[model samples]
Structures are given as structure tokens and as C-alpha cells.
Target: MTPLLETRDVGKTFGSVVALRGVSMTVERGGVTCVLGDNGAGKSTLIKILSGVHAPDSGTYLVDGEPVRFGSPREALDRGIATVYQDLAMIPLMSVWRNFFLGSEPPARGPSRALGGFDVATAKRVAREELRRMGIDIRDVDQPVGTLSGGERQSVAIARAVHFGARVLILDEPTSALGVKQAGVVLRYIAQARDRGLGVVFITHNPHHAYPVGDRFLLLNRGAGLGEYGKADIGRDELTSLMAGGAELDELAHELRRTDTPS
Candidate 1:
């Protein structure tokens, strides 16, 4: 089957600095494609292009086998591509339902728009339904989003994206700031999204977090492609080593080791 989203020879640059070089990958429907990299490994650059925050300098970006060039983030969203950043983009003091409908609130019909700007009842109903679809249970939709745990917040973000006609979901470091148990919750929701036939691009520095949920892994190193591997082609340890720059780290550690001298 053809991938839901694919990038061919994608490259990005700013002034004289190349942030990404020939980065290519695919996000298949109902599958999780984890992009793994350490700091300065071009992960952010690649995702920015994919999420429509930045345009690629040279490449072909395809959505459903049709070529596309997104001029803005809203363009991507309109094409059913949603991005969930690490921040989650929720207002702490706002109710969960309000945050869910923040920018995309349902407009009131007929005249008297001033009296009925947003359909609060519909927002709450949709938010609860979406959360339930993702296996997330909230005691009340009227509570502030800040009251929810990190994992719960991430789940809500995912649910919101899914509800908003998102066919491909890009998650940026979803588990990086959570505890072990919380991270597990986020992973489960990722699986739920995939099960619902949405292509997921999971970005993270942690190999352990990706190995279990990812169907394919794209490794990046120093703003270049390290290569792509399927789950059967790579192990957890190998993924970790590659992300850490492989043999160079081992050699550097060996050279830095201090030998004990007998007195």
C-alpha cells in the first residue's frame, strides 16, 4: 500500500547553514513512523517541514500520492495533517472543552452572532466523545486542562487532532517529559490513533520509547540521514547506538577512561 505521507529528498537550509540534507521517509496509514535523533540531528528541521512550519528547499512532499506544497500550518491542517507539539498548546486556566474548541469552535447559526458566538454545549459533547474514543476517561469536561496529568493532556491533544479530520498526526516528543507510567499512557493513545487508521509521525530522542510502538524508524545524525530501518531490521540497542553516533562514542569513551595504577 502507498504511504499516506511521503517525502522525497527533502532538504532545508537557513542562510549558509543546512538544517537538513536529503531527508526522506514515509508515514503509512495505521502505522507509527518514529524519527529518532539526538540534539542537532535535524529532527526539528524535518518535522517543521512536515508540519508546514517551514517549507523544504528541494523535495517532493506527497499526501495520498498527490504532490503538495504547504504555504502555512493552516494549509496542512486543512489537508488533514495535524501536529501535536511537546507544549500541547492548551490554556491552563481554560476548561478542557474550551481548549478543545479554542481556535476551531463551532459557529452559531442564524443572526444574533453576538449572543451565541461559540456552541459551548456542542464543544463539550464533542470533546468528551473524542476523548472516549481514545480510551481517555475524564471525570468532568468543565475542569481546567491544567488539572489533567501530562499524559492525559497529550491524549487530549491527540483526540482533538483526530476529531478535527487529521489523517496524519505528527507528535513531537510526546513522552519526553512524562514519567514511565505516564509515557506508557501516551504510547497507548498513539497505538489507538494508529488503530483508527491515522499515520503517526512520532519524534523523540529516546529509542526505548519508540521501539515498541514504531513500525519503522528513521535515524538522523548531524543534519543528515543515518538511514531508515524497519522493526525487523534493527534492535533497541542498535537504535540507541546509532542515535548516539555509533562507534565514535565508544571510541571516545575508551580514550577517556582512566587506568588505575597500583601504589
Candidate 2:
């Protein structure tokens, strides 16, 4: 079968500024395609194009080998693409189950159905079951989302996406804010999502975080692709070196040494 999502020579330009140029990569079912880039590497532009926040100025974006230009994020979601951004878009004060069924809540049954009330019982039951199925054991579905750890919060978002029939999950720097232990927790759930046959686009600047779980690595630097390599083709150290721009780092270190030298 065709890859779940793909971009061919995809590019985006904002007036005179080229945000991305000739960036290409593929996300396959049951695999993680890690997109590595630092601050201005055009990673944000690529994510926008993929999630329908913006369209590419050139090249093709295909879903399952069929080209598609999504008008809105809803269109992408309708096509089974779910994005879990860093902020997560969850209400801090809301309960876990409430946040899970936020916009797409089920209506109450029996006597309350005609009155158009929310179905609290079924929503709680389903949300609890789904979270548990994803191996996320929330202590209480009634607890405020803000009370959970960063890793737990990310897990909830991932579980929610999977429960909603998402075929592809795009995660935006999910581990950036967490500690080593918490980051490991998020990574585990990412692998969990992939194991369940969902194509995962793991966007991160940290090669260490990506290397372990990534099936493929696409490195980006200043709006261009360094290269795309399968896990077998690239080792962790090499991946880290490329991402850190080893040559540049070496030059900077040399300059610092020169400044500190005695005449």
C-alpha cells in the first residue's frame, strides 16, 4: 500500500521569504518519521502545510498516493490526520473526560435526550475505557487536566486522537518541555501509537529523543533538507552530529578558543 502521508519537493514561501524549499518525506503506517530541525528550520511551515493551517506554494502533498489540498484542519481530521501540538488545546480546569469529549460530546439518552442535555455517564465510561485501552491509567477521569504531569497530559491527547479513528498522528515537540523521565513516558506512548498501526510524524529538535523510536529521519536546516535516511542507514551519533551541525559547532568552538588565547 502507499505511504500514509507524503510530500514531494514541497515548498512554501511567505512573500520574499522562503520558509521551505524542496522538503520531501514520507510517513508510513505503523512507523515513526522523525522530522529534525531547530528554531528556523521550516519545521513549523511543514507542519502547517500538513495540518491545513497553510497550503504549500509548490509541490504536491499526498494522502495514500492521492493528492489533496486541505482547506482547513477539519478537512485533514476528516481524512484521518490528527495533530497534537505542544499546547495540546485542552482546558486546564476541565475534567479528563470532559476534555476528551469537548467538542464532539454525545447527547443524553432517554428522558434527557429530547431536552438536548450532555450524556455524562456514557462519555465518562467511554473515555475511561479508551484511556485504559491505550495503557493510560488516569487515577480519576473527574480530575482536572492541569493536575496531571506533562507526560500524562501528552498521553491523554495521544489516546484521544487514537480513539477518534486517527490514521496518522502528528506530534509537535511533545517531549521538549518534559524531564528525562517524563520525556521517556511520552516516547513510550508514541511507540504505542505506532504499534497500533498509526503513522506517526514526530517533529522534534532533539535527535536523542527521536533516534530511539524513529524508523526514518528527515533532517532540516534553514528551510532545506539535509537528507532523509532510514534507521538502518543512520546511527544515533551521526544523527546527533548532523542535527547539531558538527562543523559549525567546531568552528564556533575554535573562535571561542582564539578569543581566550594569550598573545
Candidate 3:
């Protein structure tokens, strides 16, 4: 079977500056593809290309093994490629159910398309059911989304994406700002997405966070590909060191070594 999404030797440039070159990776259904990189490591460029915010200057982007060039994020969304950004694209004051169906509300039947016409009962049920399916137990769907914890908010976004027929879930720094417990909550939900057979692109700089959940690792440095490896081919320590700049860190450590004096 073809991968849910894959990019081949993708390259992007901003006039005189090169942002990405020869970067390639595949996101498979039922697995998490972790894109690991520090700042300025082409993560932003990759996300923009994947979400259709920008087009690659070179190479091909494919969905389901078929070449596709998305002119906008809406086009990507229409193709079942949904991105849940770090900000989550949610209103803090809105209730959980309201936020779930925010832009794409279930319209009432008939010819008249009233602005406020929505199937509230059905929406609430779906919102609740979808959250539950993702192992998120919100006390009440009517409660304001801001009242929930960070992890809960992330779960709400994930469930919302899944409910809207998202075949590929692109998560940007989902665990970056959460506490240990809250981060764990989001990680479990990541696993939940994989179990549900959705191709997951987990973009983050935290190797410790990515190691446990990632099935494949794509390492990037200075806007170039380091390599991509399967879980068995790479371990946590190696992943962390590589992300932290292995030899660079060593040189810095040696340079900073304390000078000893005979006492």
C-alpha cells in the first residue's frame, strides 16, 4: 500500500537563502513519523510546504503515491491532510462542543441556510463521543475550552480533526509547553491517533519526548537532511545526542572545561 503522505528530495528557498534541500520522509498510516530538529533546522519550511503555506522550489510532494501540489491549506485539507498547529486554532472562551464544530458546523436540513442553524444535539453527541474515543474525558462538553488543562485542549483539537475526516494528522510541538503529566496525556493521544490508522507527522525538537512514541525518526540540521531511520535502527541516547549536535556539544564542553590550579 502507498504511504498516506510522502515528500521526495524537497527543497525550498527564500530568494538568496536556502531553507531546505534534499529533505525526504514518509508518513505511514498507523505510525508516527517524528521530525526532529532544533530551531532553523528546516522544520518551519517543511511544515509550510506540507500545509501548503509555501511551495517547494524543487522535488515532489505526493499523497497516496500520487504527485500533488497544493496551492493552499484549504486544498490540503480537502485532500484529508489536516494540521493541528501549536496554538490549536481554538477560541479560549468557546465551549468544547462549540469549538469542535466551530468553522464546520453541522447545518440544519432544508433549503434555508440560517447562520445560527445547527444540529446542537447531534453536534454535542459527536463531540463527546469523539473525545471519548480518543481517551479524553471532559467533565462537560458545555464547559469553556479554556477551563480545561493544556492536554485536554490538545485532545479536543485532535478529536476535532479526526471527526472532520482527517486522514493525515500534522501536529506541531504538541508537547512543547506542557508539564510532565499533561505532556504524557498528549503523547497517549498521539498513540491513539496511530492506533486509529491515521498517518501522524509529529514535529518537535524534544528528543526525549519523541523517542518513546516515534516509529520513524527524520533528523534535520541546518536546513538539510541528517538521515531517516526506523525505531530499531536508532536509540534514545543517539537521537538526543544527534539533535543536540553531538560533536558540536563535545567541542563546547571541552572549551568550557574549568581550569584547575594546584592548591
Top of the candidates by lDDT? 2
* Best by the TM-score measure: 2
Candidate 2 stretches with Cα past 4 Å from truth are none
lDDT score, candidate 3, position 68: 89
Q: What TM-scores do the predictions have?
A: 0.94, 0.97, 0.96
- What is the Å distance of residue 259 in model 2 from its true position? 3.5
- Model 1 Cα lDDT, one tens digit per residue, 1-263: 98999998888999999999888899999999999998899999888888889989998899889988899999998889999999888999999999888888997755745776877777899899889989999899999999999999999999999998999999999999999999999999999999999999999999999999999999988788888899999999999998887799988777667334334
Residues 36-144 of candidate 2 have per-residue lDDT tens digits of 9999998989999999999898999999999999999999999999999999999999999999988988998889888979899999999999998888899999999
lDDT score of residue 52 within candidate 2 = 91
Model 2, C-alpha of 80: deviation from truth (Å):
0.3
In candidate 3, stretches whose alpha carbon ends up further than 4 angstroms from where it belongs are 109-116, 258-263
Q: Per-residue error at 2 for model 2, in Å?
A: 0.9
Q: After aligning candidate 2 to the native by TM-score, how far in Å is the CA of 240 from where it should be? A: 0.8
lDDT of 1 at 152: 91
Residue-level lDDT of model 3, residues 1-263, one tens digit each, is: 79999999999999999999999999998999999999999998899899899989999999999998999999999999999999998999999999999988888765544655878888999899999998899999999999999999999999999989999999999999999999999999999999999999999999988988999999999899999999999999999999899999998787667434334
Pairs of residues at least 3 apart in sequence or in different chains that clash in candidate 2: none
